[model samples]
Target: MQQLAFYQSLWATERRRPGVPERPVSERFDAVKADGYHGMAIDLGAMTLEQARATVPEFARTGLGGLLTAFPQSVDDLRPAIRLAKDIGSPFLIVIGQVMPLSVAGMIPVIREWLALARAEGMPLQFETHRDCITNDLFATVQLLDAIPEMRMAADLSHYVVNREMLYPIRPEYRALISRVLARCDSFQGRVASRNQVQVPIGFPQHAKWVATFLDWWTEGLAGWRGRAGPDDTAIFMCELGPPEYALTDARGDELSDRRQEALQIRAMVEDRWKALGA
Candidate 1:
């Protein structure tokens, strides 16, 4: 049977509220486990290798599965992260390559090099579709995928929604492009976005249409994964609602909505989609 595992983002636990101290790693791990998450994700994009390494013990203590999202500043920067992920028993590493190349031709070698390195290290790796990285532009990412058919991606389409400033009733061309990306996406992340905003409150009335758009994309992505994935294969759907700037804040620097509640709601939506697949 193909199984769907939901993972919580450790970085999302960050409140970054004024005068509010950060929660300890153990406490975050406890909360995730208690919430019934199958695993947790650590973002090297936001944390250093040492900082990410420090959480290994907590992951073990809680008996939770782990995933690492790496922001490799250089092609070789991914090497250490890969080693650490293997050491911590992470199933795979998600690469958000910070090394930006100016043109599509310029980007191919960089991606190929990193993919080759991951293979050499015997690490399962997926390039993330994100902003401010190698796969920054939607058109560029489509070009890269066409050029490198073997490359797999962790789809975080919120970035594209914001990047393209996509309008509701998305243009046919845009929808087709997203379909292409979803076809090759090996994993998915949950974060709804509108044309102007990167992260919107899912339950907000004004954001309902955007939320519906994201749900539809996720449903299509999950169904595509099931079509190709073998029996006993497990796919991870990450609820990665971010914090602070990635998350909207009011004048007092307080989040407008309950992030934890939002995460749970997104997780449930994905879970329902998975169940509907009968996988």
Candidate 2:
């Protein structure tokens, strides 16, 4: 049977602002496990490599599955992250490469180099669709997919939606672009976004249409995964509702909505979609 796993982002759990005290890593891990999450993602973009290394023992303590996300500026920088992912028992390492080039043609060899490094290390790597990374542009990313037939992606559709400044009633051209993206997606990240914002409060009435759009895309992505994946493989869906900048802040720097609740809600939504497929 195929499995679907939900992972909570440690970065999302942070509440570092003016008044609120930040939660300890231990408390955060405990909450993630207690909330019924099967895994936790350690984002190197938000923490130092040593800090990420320090958390491995805690994964064993909490019995939560582990994942590592790296923002490597060079292909060589990714090797240590690959080893760390192996140490943490992560199924794969998620790469959001910071090396941005002028053109998609320039990006092809960089990607191939990173994939070759991971292959050499005996680790699986998935390039993420995120802003400020090699796969930042939707149009360019589509070209990269064409250029590299074996490339698999960890889809975070929120970035593409905002990067393209998409509006409701998605155009056929944009829809075709998104379909190409979803077809290559090996993993997914959960965050509702409008064209203007990277992260929107999912329960807000104003965001309903965009929420519906993402759900439909996620369902399609899952169905595609079902068709392509091995019988016992697991689909990892990460709830990545980030803190501060990603979360909309009010006048006093307080988030407008409860992210913990929203993360759980996203988890439930994906779980329902997976089950509805009924193998």
Candidate 3:
């Protein structure tokens, strides 16, 4: 079976706790493992290279290893983070581009630069579909794909749902566009979103329609991946349901429920979809 991992926004959330000492990376690793997660995608956008290197050993201690998600400003800036990923035994170096250029043509050089760097360093790389980055806008990303045929992506459809403002009960036209994205994606992310909202709690009555919409998209995406990929290919599925603010939090700063449980639920859903596709 393809491996699944959780995304850790540890650096971002650790700072949110005013009085509490930041949770040890070991603690974060333990938390995910206890929740039945196989691995974790370390979000390094909030940390410097040196900080990331210092923190990775903690993840290694927990036996969790996966991608390093970064928003490096320059291609060369990715060197240490890539090295850190290698040290942690993560096979993928995932980049969610942060610097946006004036035009689609302007974005090519950045992609080329990162591609060159990854190639030179022997690091596997994939761009993530996320907001406030070079791939921020869905329309622009389509253009970028046409320009660069080799560009691989990790699909986080929450951003595109918000970018396009897709209504519930996905229209065939919108579904077609999404299918294009699914065709290009090598990995999938976990999050349920409506056209208007980026993140919504799973299992809420109001969020059910959007959740179903995402499930349908995931089914299609996974089926497409399985069909296109060879027997040796492994497609990653990341359960990235974020915490506190990204998750719904109650009073007293505690999460409404367990975010880890929510991630597991999403993982199960994806696994079921993949199995159904196989059947």
Candidate 4:
């Protein structure tokens, strides 16, 4: 049957305290499993490949799902990342391509090659909408999607919002553009962002509208996926509320909200909306 699963990002747990040592991967996995997440996702940009490989046994021991987000700098760079993801037995691989091609036509071949390689390796892959990558620009990404019909995306609306410096009470043109994005999403990401900030505390009074807006987008995206996907397909919605820098910080450089709690809240919100989509 079609279903959705939630994951917590390992990077989200970073530097929760400035002077304190980071927790071990085994301990982190235990915490993720205890927190009732179905999986944990590791960021390649955050750790060396050897470091990522070291955690494979922990994922095996915990029996939780696994996912990898890769930052590939070239067409051939995806190879090892896919292999590591296979070791973790991830449901899919997310690529934030660092190969910046100035034009859409220039990008087409790079993306097509990555897709072909992943398909040959028997890995499911989707490019993530993020900053400082090939899909970084909103206009360029939309164009790339149209140019390559098979190119699937894992939507992280936070980057796009901040990228566009989107104004609130979103204009009709802005909503239309976002609708095109939602229509093409193969998966959804969790984070509430205003045009000014990349990540904000979800429960704050000022952030409520943005929260509501994100939920609306996710609901529309998932419902659309349900309509098109086969009965047995599964959907993944990862809660990637990142650490300070990604998170809003106080003057002291401390996080303004409990990120773990916010991640869970995002999961709950998505779960509620997914249930109401009807089987």
Best candidate (score: lDDT)? 2
Q: Could you tell me every candidate's TM-score relative to the true structure?
A: 0.98, 0.98, 0.90, 0.97
**Model 3 per-residue lDDT at 211:** 81
As a TM-score, model 2 comes out at 0.98
TM-score of 3: 0.90
Candidate 3 Cα misplacement greater than 4 A, ranges? 1-21, 250-254
Query: lDDT rank, highest first?
Result: 2, 1, 4, 3
Model 2: residues with Cα > 4 Å off, grouped in runs: none
lDDT of 1 at 192: 93
Candidate 4 lDDT over residue span 1-279, tens digit each: 898988888898787667878998889889999998888898998899999999899888998888999999887899999999999888789999999989889999999999999999999888998999999988888888898888888989899989999988888888888888888888889999999899999989999999999999999989989989999988888898887778878798877888889888999989999998874
Residue pairs with backbone atoms closer than 3 Å in model 3 (clashes) = none
What are the RMSD figures for all models against the true structure? Answer: 0.9, 0.8, 2.4, 1.1
Candidate 1 collision pairs: none
Q: Write the per-residue lDDT of candidate 2 for residues 1-279, one digit (tens) a residue.
A: 999999999999999797768988999999999999999999999999999999999899999999999999998999889988988889999999998999998999999999999989998889899999999999999999999998999999999999999978889999999999999999999999998999999999999999899999999999999999999999999999999888999998889999999999988988999999964
| lDDT measured at residue 156 in model 1 versus the true structure, 0 to 100 | 99
Question: Per-residue lDDT of 1-279 in model 1, one digit per residue for the tens?
Answer: 899999998999888777889999899999999999999999987788899889988878998899999999898999999988976678889999999999999999999999999999999889898999999999999999999998999999999999999999899999999999999998999999999999999889999988888999999999999999999999999999999898898888888888899999999888888898884
Which has the better lDDT: candidate 1, or candidate 2? 2
What's the C-alpha lDDT at position 132 in model 3? 88
